[model samples]
Target: MLKHTGRRQQILVALVAFLVSALATVLASTVTTASPSVQPGSDGKSGSPGATSTKPSAPSSLSDPRKPLPIGLAYGDTLTWKNDQELAVGLGDAVDSGAKWIRVDLSWNDIQPDSPKTYEWQRFDRVLNGARARGLEVLATIGYTPKWARKAGCSTDDACPPADPAKFAAFARDAAKRYASQGVHMWEVWNEPNIPFWAPKPDPAGYTELLTATSKALRQADPQAYVLMGGLAAVGTDPSIAYVSQGDFLTAVCKLGGNKVVDAISYHPYTYPYLPSAKTSFGTAMEDISSAQGNLVSILAGNGTPDLPIWITETGAPTNGPGTATDGKTIPPDTTHVTEAYQAAIATDTVQAAAANPHVGAVFWFSDQDTGQAADKQHRSMFYGLRHFDGTPKPALAALKAAILAYEHSR
Candidate 1:
């Protein structure tokens, strides 16, 4: 969620350590940033560079893989500028890969850049059109305040919260009305409100205030639609960072009755190096989202929102980053580096873990394709994609498809 802002300084510092490894040699000899086995298409077709053309085979009719537990994906901003053909291939891949849902941004800043009276829906309309044609469900994330709406004296960043909650609610109501015909009902309020994405500083009470108004507006626009609080981050406490941890932030929100405002809870459990299915007493976020005593699971139950569902809106690991001479086998504190095989295992295990947990409703991988080689905030984020930047499918893609199929058939 804070992808554009390199504000996770503590996490970024640990991510910088990701580099080439004498240790990675033990994991797999041919493993590197560029996987040798990466091919052009998921369906055996050849696509030229930049993923311009690689027709994924039509999704199999054998059985609906999305029946029991489905996987969803966010393509980052790759589809924002792609042509219709390229957009079809990306969405097509999601269908062929067993994804039932597709997450999209309905940014307030983008749709209403000037006066609040004027609105633009064409850009998002194009994406939603493609998603519906592919039979994919939409989770529209609503946030990124326009400059006019930002509180006075705040930095000129889009992450700033609006000066008034009612104004923000009006925007949400309009977005929901405009898209109700297109079958977009699920809404995720803001992205990463527990961090700098909320701007200046994160405030649980303030976010609860915003959610109360926004959720009401969404349901009013379409009575059937559900609202999800923005996906809280998945990292533990670090003395270096000024942001509140997801656990503490959720506690404050629940204390203020936030759980009663939103229809469900959204969380991002981005576990790398270690898998989400692991059971241990370690301080990883898996405990915070799942088994730990004071975790969010218990938080909701104690707060009187016992039946509320948990949506894993985002989670995934990167296969490679800036290669370092340090031993990658030992694993650094915040690095996202893992081999392609390991990443594939993450795809499979993430589904398995969610399927085993009754509280988790859906799982969407953070990205659909690798973005680029350049690092953001010293973290090589490009490699998190299940496919290469050139539109070639990675091993993780097939792993995700198989996991979804397994889950469906078992049910």
Candidate 2:
């Protein structure tokens, strides 16, 4: 009878153990089926099959934060006007003033006037060799369509776009090949294409086509070449004068995929008659050029190119130094005139502002020295140089040097 009771008790304990195990298995199955494995960025959300996560990563910047912002000089026609001795003096001043780059006009017309096969690179060769000798990098502005390459009715207009994009591309390839060995890696596609002064009329699509052709040719010639978009003139919207606002022009160009070809966007953010920090009627401030830069960043980001750099390729105030008005009257000196003192102060402030902005890769003072052309007198472009036409140093030269040095040291 005791053996029978022991067997019965053992059976009862086994039954309880089996029941518990079954309950645990059922619970485990329930939990396993209820919970789904989620991948990173999924956050337990459902998506279409093969769809990527909607979360966007941080946008990248084109400006290399690792490198110091280079200070450059926009001595446009200076190279063409100055002899070897004069060129040396100008470049010497640039180097002494802490400028690492000098922008010179590489006129397409001058290079190949008659035919694409006919090349006259003597002037450019001298200028480029001179610049390299002085340890100054060149940002060659290669544009101004030759008469033979201009479109119909645009024969005399150097500002006209090439009749054929291939012609421009050929020119770009030749120039890049010729100068690639001289450390001339940076090229500004053209001057201000956003105005009639550069293009017959601002056509973003045409500009993009030209830029793409030129850029591809350049990269093919020199794998390390950087193609910067033409510096957009900082002019107000005046369609009557064929002037598109800088913001509008940039937006249009960027939308048309200009960012795809160009490594950087260049602008002449001149707040002439006002400080760089002053606000324009268009609700943007010139002092903090970053505001305009930010607009460009947004445009590029929207176009899936968030990493393009912004170059202030031209920015400086022009002084009214010994110039008469076109009306045959003495131009009265006013406080508005970019005097020596004001130019110095402005130069210091402009560089300081640009250096502080991470988007700004370079700041090019409009000119190294003033020009003597009578036509320049009618426009402010004639007097935006750091030195007078005679090569005497303007107060802005010392100020710019000090500003660049201080900024570099601080960095």
Candidate 3:
């Protein structure tokens, strides 16, 4: 995802420049991948023990609520980070192009690097404020265990509670309390907790416990704020692997009394090379997620939480593969590398899918711009953003604008 050269860098400079802006919690114990044997809470409600349901005002129309924009978040720990200014511009672009919401990750580890007393709100203030200023709601992800809160042998991004469960819970409570004040309401407890991305060995039971605890903290902080279950990564391709299949993870959670714990289910359906439909081959990038979604819904229904919605909180298709083409051209997909058309079509499709799916409440495209994380930064790779590596918009940019116009007109 690295930028090619000076010309490329300048082309994407606007996105990077605006980013000079903006900027989670937890608990712990012996984290094992064990499963609870009892049936899940199917009492038609969700809350910590002895807590009662306090439903928020329902949507104007449940029939076909305008889905949230399938967009991206400005993630941290990367070289090409996004600042508040860049985020504002990116969100403005998305809003102008018909996006209803924007996803922003509020890393628990980074925010509470030490203790709840050492909370950091400056970074997030910029991002949340910027997006809101442009009329975009936030789908905030609140997770990432800091080194201090993790257990022993937790070497990588994935691992258990940094130190203890109480500390994690404190962090979670503080996050809910603070964000609630900021008006950046929707909250996702963690990111793919069922996978190694959060925990090395798919610890479904342990994650359920984490979700339950975090959900309690959030509900206490702000009854009005929406709390979504973390999206599970697609793990259906192999049963024997250590990863937890998103479907199976849901099933396990349902069994562990997790049905009434959160408001909705979130997911990361990273279908690469974009399949035209979910019925594509198993190997097809997003096909597995499409398939997993089917199974997950069934699991939810069986647990009697069928009314809960699904949010493709994160989803996108890379536009940079050699075999890739938008409407059928072999050109590159970024501003510098290719025309704006490819990027626009990809953005349009992301919007189209989000709008079409009735079950999906939101769809935040994976990013605002590429941060040059690795090699092979395709014209439309993750490193490939709406604008070129420099500050120019590719075909995708303009295409997205047209699609947004059509979307608004449809209303």
TM-score of each: 0.79, 0.78, 0.74
Taking the tens digit of each residue's C-alpha lDDT, what string does model 3 give over 234-347? Answer: 656354556767777888888997767877788777654443233443443244333444566667788977766677766554544454545422323532232235445556
lDDT, each prediction: 0.74, 0.74, 0.60
List RMSD in Å for every model shown: 23.3, 11.5, 21.2
The better candidate by TM-score, 1 or 3, is: 1
After best superposition, candidate 1 residue 254: deviation in angstroms?
0.9
TM-score for candidate 2, residues paired by index: 0.78
Runs in model 3 deviating more than 4 A are 1-88, 155-160, 237-241, 276-278, 281-294, 321-343, 373-375, 378-381
> With candidate 1 superimposed using the best TM-score fit, by how many Å does residue 37's alpha carbon deviate from the native?
51
In terms of TM-score, how similar is model 1 to the real structure? 0.79
Minimum summed lDDT over a 10-residue window in model 1 is located at 43-52
Candidate 1 lDDT by residue in tens digits, 92-194: 8788789888887888888888878887777778888999887888888999899999999984998999999999999999998988777777788998888
